[model samples]
Target chain A: MGSDRSARYPDGGDTGTDRAPRDGGGRADTGVGRRGFLRAGVLAAAGLAFGRPLLGESAADVVRMVGARGPDDEMTDAVREVLKAKFGDRRIQTGHVQLDIPTDAPDGRAVPTILDIDLPITPNSYVATYHLLVDHNPDIYLAAYHLTAGSGEGPIETRIKMRRTGYVRAIAEMNTGELWSAAVKVFVGLNGCG
Target chain B: MPSMHHDSSRDAPTLTFTMPAGAPSSVGEAKILLPLSVARDAVIDVRALLVHPMDTGFFRDAEGNPIPAYFVNAVTVTYGGEQVARFEWTSGISRDPFVRFPLRASREAQVQVVWKDNKGGVYQQAVDVKFA
Candidate 1:
């Protein structure tokens, strides 16, 4: 199983290629050498600067999803179901956001996704929460991110598993209760629901 | 049967793990990758990687047995002793979850990421942000 997982996500190793741009061209070694050294140094410096318990008890904040009325808008039935269940009666406008993803993803195990919201993150008005929804998947609610004004221009970059190929929707709820959404349809090959 | 794998190249810094004495061993180790250099008030990307199966309970093992659902349900990010962001995730997330979000680096502070699984297991890692 481990080998299978590795084969599926080849770049899952500590290649550090993802950090190339952040390093400011200090070193661009793709292999495990100079780049890896700097990565280790950064981690080491962070550890020494602030050492504390990694794990401890915390108040469990469990999420409960209840069904509700779907949004009155123009969208696919699958997406409407999700919107209805997640954000009922909230007018979900279709603008001010975009889903940055590949149109055709050959692999479904890890499809790179970026949700970019062109909104100001200020104390008075900011995107408070962003919900990632897939039209067709084992579960539609991929994730919901809560952000405050301190998050700056909230842009989320992550990898998601698509059971098949369908629309990936991102809905951002502002602090003023304004709901804005954007979606993109993707073609995915190779089932990644495993 | 969660396992921990640290890259051979990394120095393997102090990654504090808090597994209870009699509890089932959960997969340990997570890391926060910050830019080596950052200017004042620059909105930089804070990348985090967590090790977890994120099993969706929809897949079967090699022996045809159903794999139970196990995944990180919540991820909280705190900076300078204040909660900046929190994520509510489901099994739809891929294995070995990796996430990057933009954060304004106003001053030097400690950034901590906490990953909570559905089985009441909490895993976390922290890194200090220093301005260049």
Candidate 2:
């Protein structure tokens, strides 16, 4: 679950650059104070131009900083939990599974996504199941698909609703005891979690 | 010709199956396309389109009343009477859901798909698989 905090406060400190003196120097009686104030002013200007929030930090800030860093942590944990419950402690590797989602989605309500397993579908070694998950949604598990000898070799395309900007993941389990996964970060302009 | 009947009432849930071209068919709002056969050790593609409002119950009406939640709860696919895949869905799933997946072609068997909605309605479809 990526947050706007790091992007807001790169240094992760409590110093309010906005409180700097107008002339970029606070009580220039001390040369060090003058330099510090000037630096603060410059940082404040950059933050404002970059659209970083200037308000006091909230609990969300602490949570965002302490919780899972990106979609990989949250999504991987969810997938691992499901797999562990179903197949035990099996190794899951990245690759072979392709997840397609727009980097920026104007409407989170109907973000079109596709999942394709690149491996050949053979009776001896084939993709048997797929799990789609979303980090930061009310329900992390979005949907699951099971493929059999009756299914074709085409990519699965569908529209999924996201609660907010987060990571989306796809995991495929092969019949030969191999699990492949893929994920993508999506920026949602309009929240659709509801 | 098999006629499709649309019924919104919760008491009667409709279920129908349609095979590829040249088979006895019933036209319904929902359709699942499955290949008739595939070469041995080949991959088989399965696709399905289901009809449902998938109302999230979050939106409000003109009078400001919230709509009740109604959507598909579960979908499962089976091959030769063996479980293949199962999906648990939420309101996040798109309206009139369309799903696709792949399977390893092995032998001649029957593929079955079943979906159950929140309103206690169960729908099912099936097709035969021929391996070359």
In model 2 chain B, the worst 10-residue window by lDDT is B1-10
lDDT of 1 by residue, A28-72 (tens): 454447767677667655654432211111222111101111111
lDDT of 2 by residue, A1-194 (tens): 11233344444343444544555554555455756776877777776553333245466754543342331233344544655675565666666788888979977777888888788765466666677888656667787766654453457777888766667878887767687777778877666655
Q: For candidate 1 chain A, which ten residues in a row score worst on lDDT?
A: A61-70
Query: Where does candidate 2 clash, by residue pair?
Result: A148-B103, A149-B104, A151-B44, A151-B45, A151-B46, A152-B44, A152-B45, A152-B46
Full-model lDDT, candidate 1: 0.72
Q: Can you list each candidate's DockQ?
A: 0.29, 0.27
True contacts kept of each: 0.81, 0.57
Best by DockQ: 1
TM-score of 2: 0.60
Which residue runs does candidate 1 get wrong by more than 4 Å? A1-78, A152-154, B1-26
True contacts kept of 1: 0.81
